[model samples]
Target: MTPAARTHRTAVLALHYQNDVLHAQGCIRVGLAEDDPARERVIAAAGQLIAGARQLDLPLIHIRIAFRADYADLIQNCQIFRQTAQLGAVKDGTWGAAFFSGLEPIEDREHEFVLRHHRTSGFIGTPLELLLRKLGTRHLIVAGVATHSVVEMTARHAADLGYEVTIAADACAAARAEVHKASLASMSLIAEVGSVASALASEKDSR
Candidate 1:
């Protein structure tokens, strides 16, 4: 991790909304009810990252996708999920919109993350930057599923904003291994890509 990212409010994004929309098969699978093995693994990986980060006490946060009660707050702004809504997907308060379990989510607690609605890039519609700025976070370590989609897009935005970014390699996943590796390859020259252990191994190095 770059000096900027290692200390700058490192946040590991947790995963949800595992749709088959980008999968080999064109099926929008639901959560545990219609669990996808690949998606489960992705969630499991994210959970492990969250648990471990807690152990490490990294300045972390969590985010989940959602829509307002009227849903009017989103429809026009969202390009991707707007179409998804047409397909009977991602209702506002439904189970489908909830972040996958195993993230060690708190019922009611401090430092909890805010939920976003139809916002693809976590930083786009949310006050993530303001929150980070408040925390004095200029560097970010990002992790989650589907590196090509959400992960890649967010990383690009982070870099453009002059925030040093590192994507934990093993902490994220794509629909397929090829896509995952390809996304990392695309990011390697731009973003520091490595495992969570290797990313934080430097704390060990500093010792």
Candidate 2:
């Protein structure tokens, strides 16, 4: 990628560092892991990705999942979110809906954008496209939780929407190792799949 183009790349953290997903007592933490080596590794990689993006001064876009208290905006047809409704997870204004501490953008960072979505894809029903266009984002560096769900869906959607997508495989997590690997394989067909270090290195090389 050209240096000018790479300068417009956005680092998207999709539901990775969120209370409902990454916390020990989180409602959906069961979908990933707790006190496990794989989970720890994933978290560490994602944290490094965030730190790298900050070092590069890239736009940091934090995508979170949240629904209304009454679940009116949540579609019951989506099987994945049914568990969220049942468990009362990610309710707006609750701790479960907040971004994890030490992982979110600090206040007064003008380039940092936080988006709340009720569905799997970040672009769906969100101003993400408009924001990206406004920011002139040509590529996306994606890292998130539940590789088979939010991470995969967002990467595919971004690719189809004309944005170059790169999946930080090491920075993504799933309910199981097999599932995570499967998701990465599937995503590799559509987007570049690599570790956070490689992604950052690619950016630097491009520059």
Candidate 3:
């Protein structure tokens, strides 16, 4: 098949790099060990990815998962959502819902945007797609926590929405190594699987 024409407009979607998921005191860090090398690697790589995006002047969109204090708007269709309220994790206005250190959007920056979602995919129940459309972004570089869920689902949703999707594999982490590997493999079928370095290089080259 012939390759699609490059649009040159790309944005980075940083999802779920919140304190509740990455912090040692996070409630959602249940199965994730505080000292896990894989988790640390993800944090480092994601930090690098964000820095690279900023240096390249690419639009950076930080997607977070947060619910109301009582979670009245939260859907309970999934175990994760159900457990969210029980664990009191990612409650809006709490530190747990805040972005992790060094991974936050620069306030007052025109290129940096923030969107919150209650579902697994950033596009669902959020203005992510609308914002991307307004910015004329046809290509997306995605990185986030829980490769099996948010990363995978959001990339898939972006692909289905006709946006070229690339996953920063090294910038994503899961509670289990095997699950992370399996999720990346599965997502490869729908999105380009690459590391933060590769994604940055591609963006630089495109410019």
Instruction: Give lDDT: candidate 3, residue 138.
Output: 94
CA RMSD (A), model 1: 5.9
Off by over 4 Å in 3: 1-8
lDDT of 1 by residue, 49-163 (tens): 7776666665566655555645666655565666555555555566555555456466354444655635657788778788777667666778865577677887888888888
Per-model TM against the reference: 0.75, 0.92, 0.94
User: Tens digits of per-residue lDDT for model 2 on 1-207?
Assistant: 645543365555545478888887888873655667776787788788888887888788888888899999889886777888999998988999888776876657767788888788888888988888877888899988889888988899999988888998888888888998999999888899999999989988887
Write the number of the candidate with greater lDDT, choosing between 1 and 2: 2
Q: List the residue pairs that clash in candidate 2.
A: none
- Score candidate 1 by lDDT: 0.62
What TM-score would you give candidate 3 relative to the actual structure? 0.94
Among residues 3 or more apart in sequence or in different chains, the pairs in candidate 1 whose N, CA or C atoms overlap within 3 Å are 169-194
Q: What Cα-based lDDT does every candidate model obtain?
A: 0.62, 0.82, 0.89
| Residue 23 miss distance in model 3 (angstroms) | 0.7
Q: How much is the lDDT of residue 120 in candidate 2?
A: 82
In model 3, which range of ten residues has the least summed lDDT? 3-12
